[model samples]
Target chain A: MRTTIMPSVRILIFFTILTGILYPVGITFVALGIFPYQANGSMVERNGRVVGSELIGQGFTGDRYFHPRPSAIAYDPVPSGGSNWGPTDARMADSVAARRDAFIRKNGVPGDVVVPKEMLFASGSGVDPHISPDAALLQMERVAAARGFDTQKSDALKELVMRCIEPPQYALFGEPRINVLSLNLALDALEKGYPPPF
Target chain B: MITVSELIQLMLYALALFLLTPPLGKLMAMVFRGERTFLTPALGWLERVAYRVSGIDPDKAMDWKGYLWSLLSFNAFGFAVVFLLQFFQSSLPFNPQQLPDVSWHLAFNTAVSFMTNTNWQSYAGEVTLSYLVQMLGLTVQNFVSAATGIAVLLALVRGIAGRSTGSIGNFWADLTRSIVYLLLPLSIILSLFLVSEGVVQTFSGSRTVTTLEGVQQTIPLGPAASQVAIKQLGTNGGGFFNMNSAYPHENPTPFSNFLQMLSILLIPSALVYMFGAMVNARRHAWVVWGVMFFLFAAGVTLSLWSEYTVNAVTGVGGGMEGKETRFGVANSILWSVATTAASNGSVNSMHDSFSPLSGTVAMMNIMLGEIIFGGVGAGLYGMMIFIILTVFIAGLMVGRTPEYLGKKIESFEVRMAAIAMLLPSAGILLFTALASVADAGLAGLNNQGPHGFSEILYAFASTAGNNGSAFAGLTANTPFYNTLLGINMLIGRFGVIVPMLAIAGSLAQKKITPLSSGTFPTDTFLFGVLLTGTMLIVGALTFIPAQVLGPVAEHFLMLNGKVF
Candidate 1:
């Protein structure tokens, strides 16, 4: 027992230093050297001021910008979580109903048309950064109206939104999504010429 | 109303898994046998250096008792180190977040969880653990604990193959080789892929940025892709972010999501084939794999149907509330079933938001002993336990001594197998019952009535099964849950492992008997059905009452438009 214990403890300590410290540090350097932009949170900038991470959702309430999915945690990164509300939970039902009503009133969409599920439901991570391309398109008219664009500009804006549509990775994995942060950053870029957010 | 595209995706996933299993299994068998492989030249030096530095005689086998002692002591040391690290986290390097020391109970729970390969987090990672602890303390355990599982399984395999030998293979050798040859190389490739797909891998602190709405938001960053790789590949599912895989940074693109999902089942599923090659029972291995595949397919189908069916509350056809829209309904439901079945418990969607029937399927997958494709090496040994019981029952019906793979079913082996089988079930039931009635337990309940009961039930079930996914509704950070769950994780992991080793010890000492006309063929379709039936019966008999009190009742209540 003693023989096993001493060697096992020593090995544990050795592996801890190897895996815990050296491995991650090694990986960190490689990632930084090769994929620096992504490895460092993929932050988008405008006029030398950092705006938001491309990976996380931002609170975009103005009709001029397409909103991200409803965040259950108010988009807080430090303590990210889901609402964890069951479909049958009364509070969840109430919140969904409230979100649906708000979506109809604010977006001025016809009630008869089925609102996309992403528009009505709070995402798993209150910090979901994407809305489906269809969801984004539904709010396109409102975003164009908010920006005070003419028909020609609105058509170009729609083209810009189409560019923001990320195809399903591998052509079969996830759904097509428009990053709200990127789209809104593009909206800012339209007003002032700047490189588009990645 | 399952879409053709969803069916295609499922078919692709199954096809990919089938195609990948044999070569991986062959490579693993080579590793375990200390033979030459493609990776030997690259990783062989590390294996030799590990043994030399630790003074472990790679050729020296130990009796089952010695193996168990080494396993237990090593894990104990790991637990102590992790506990101490959390207590003194404020002083640790890489804590750019300036996190405080973890409370005593949480430190205890976290320590036991990682050491046991449970990875059940009561607190969010970025907020609680320093990067030092996440990497050194938790991530290190992710590799070693998973290696420990594979090590034990190797010992068991040696025991089955031995002829009157008292010694199983060296635990140290098995553990070292598993990490050096298998886990390390796989993790490096997977991590690089994940980083390419934009999963964050950095040492920088959280970045505060101004949003389009003009609100200041802080985005957390760290060495996430590195941890995410091993976390999924090793079947240790601790998440860097609190939202787990649902966080875009941790599982950014659909390609990343698909890769992570595939890696979860890769090792465990391959291990079944490895077992067959080791014991010279390739046919038997495929039969067992077939049984596991059937169960996995059934689970995925049930979850998909339930998720797509109309719910009474919203009067909606699809249950998409807690699912990530990028993964959509099919991917989320598929991920939920795969994660649960493999005991790789990182969720791309919240299980708590799943409709009752879907939630029930998730719970049932864990309750079925997580052997559809369980965590790393643990799943195969666990399924073997059920197989022993099936053979034992068959012996009684035939009025003859039962044999499996040419080994006679002895009293001692049967008793030890029973202990291995029952201990986790006991932990799940007793702890859940106690928590249901206790004030300390009730304090953490986030929902009312049946769903609340389901949360409590899911916690213990996850802990006991060593499947770390949670209902996510329960606030398990309190002292009561931390200590109780800590103990539960230990019992669930080691309690079963000890008896399994004992069975291995007993079997190793017995001489192999020749097969007869009535040896009860384990490779037959009837035996597969019988083995699966034994698993279902044990699970149903033990957990149906609790399931009724929780998800089962919740299902019926939801039909009546009742919300808990």
Candidate 2:
């Protein structure tokens, strides 16, 4: 029993240190040298102030900005998660109805105008930073109206949204998407200088 | 229901997987047998060092009882260590976030989840656990637990091919070789590649940053690339962050996404060929691989169709809700089916928002024992159980004594095989029943109606099957789910393993008989179909009623244009 049990305990401890401490730390050390910006969290910086991570979603509720997907966690990065509501659930249907109604009223689009499903549905992570290109385009009217932009400004805004559209990853895998933060930042940059103040 | 593009993507994914299986499988066989190969000179020193350090005698073999005890004790130690780490994380080094201790039930759940290689997470990763717990507790279990599965598998394969012997090989030796030669080297290479592709690998704490809308947000950071590499390679599936592979840091580029998806099945797929090599029957391995591929292809076809069809309630096609656009619909559906089929439950899309029929397809994959290139060593063993049952049934029909690989299928072996097969079934059905009736279980539900029922069923199925993906609608942090699911994880993993080991013990003692006209050749296509059929019939018959109540009913409701 001693022979069987003692070696097991010692091996467990040895492997734990090897895998738990040395391996991850060693990898982190190498990553720090080569991919520091990403290894640290992909934090985007502007005007010497740290902005959001390129990978994570942030809350952007103002009508002047193109909204990302509905986040069940309200874009809380710490406790990121989806709504977890099933499609047939009454709560999900009601929430979708409410979001659609609000979106229709806010955007001032016709009642029959087809809304992008991503607008009404919550992302699984609750921190999805991208929305479908169509989802972003659908919100263009509301964002333009809120910014009090004229025809030329609205068209420029449209052009910016088009430019912001990221092609499907590798032109093979994902859907074409527009990063919400990037688009909103571009919106701000269009108005002012490169730093784009709040 | 599937579109042309979706079909193309599914076909391409399947083609790539099948094309790579044979060589990888043969390489794994060589690795297991201690044969000299290309990686031997480089990795052989690491294996010898591991043996020397652990004081494990690689030449000494153990009977089935010794192997089972060592496996159980080793896992028990892991569970204890993980549980203790969760309790003491605040004091642990590298905890830059200053995260506190975890609750008892949740800690128990997390420990068992990782130890069983299920990797189910009831709590969000970023807020609950510090970096120390993630590495020392969870990541360690990811390696050992996966190695444990492979070790058990090698034992079984040896038993099948043993010549009048009771010894099934040294548990410590197999476990060590599995980690040193197979898991460790692969993880190191994959982790480096993932880091190159922008998956995070750092000790830095969460960074506070301003959003474009002027809101201050904290973006969580950790040694994600390392963990993600092993999680997929080992089929562990626990996410470093709450979002799993969907979180771009965990899976940043399309190339990385493809790599991660490929890694999930790489070992499990190779193990089939390894089984053939160990048994000296390479043709039989191809037969089993064919069966698994066919089942996988069928599941993906159903899922693609279900996902592509326009929603009845929303009147929208391309089921984009709860899916990351970066992984689009086609890739997401492929991943959904592949993850479940492999019992590697890391997901790029939320299964909860998948159309009802599609969600059912994912559930069916797990419920069918996840043997379509299932988890590393666990999948082939699970498939072997069904193969045993298939041969036994065929023997009964022919009025002849049943034999597999020259070993007779006696009452004891059949009894053990039956127990091995039925244990997970019991875990799924019994727990689902308990949770359905209990107020505590009802409280965890996020949706109402049949979809809600499916959420509970899916949780139990995922745990009991040792596949960790969840429907995402159930709040499973409470003690009821935490403890119950923990029990399920244990029963699901070991219940099958122990009985399978006992069968190996019995089989190892049998003398080989010469093949005659009566001998049933398992290497044939007909036998492969029989094996697959037996698996599906057993699964479908056991779980169909529950399925009808959940996803099936929901599917019908959608067709009626009625949201729950």
Q: Which candidate number maximizes lDDT?
A: 1
Off by over 4 Å in 2: A108-112, A141-156, A193-198, B1-5
> Ten-residue segment with the worst summed lDDT in candidate 2 chain B?
B1-10
Prediction 1 TM-score vs. true: 0.98
Any residue pairs clashing in model 2, and if so which?
A84-B473
* Tens-digit lDDT string for candidate 2 (B1-564): 444544565566667777788787888888788788898888788778777887888888899998888888888889999999998888878789888899999999999999999999886788999898999998899999999999989999989999889999889888888887788889999998898877888877887876777777877888999999999999999999887887777877667888888888888988988898889888988899889888888887788777777766766666566777577777788888888987789988789988898899899889887888899899989888888899999999888888988888888888988898788889999999999999999998888889888999999999988999999879999999999999998888988999999989989988988788998888898898888889889988999999999999988898776876
lDDT of 1 at B485: 89
Per-model fnat list: 0.74, 0.65
**Cand. 2 Cα-lDDT:** 0.84
Question: Model 2, A93-125: lDDT tens per residue?
Answer: 677778888888877788998877678777767
- Give i-RMS (Å) per prediction: 1.2, 1.8
Residue B98 in candidate 2, Cα distance off native in Å: 1.5
TM-score of each: 0.98, 0.96
What tens-digit string does per-residue lDDT give for candidate 1 at B1-564?
666666777888999999999999998999999999988888788888887888888898799999999998999899999999999999888899899999999999999999998899887998999998899899999999999999989998988999999888999999999998888889888998899888999888888887778898988899999899999998889899998999988988778888999999999999999999999999999999999999999988888888887777776766567777778888888888888887778999899989887888888888777889798998998888899899999999999998878888789889988888788888988999899999999999878878999999999989888889999999999999999888888888987799889888888888899988888988989989998899888888988898898888887888777865
In order, what is each prediction's RMSD in angstroms?
Answer: 1.3, 2.2
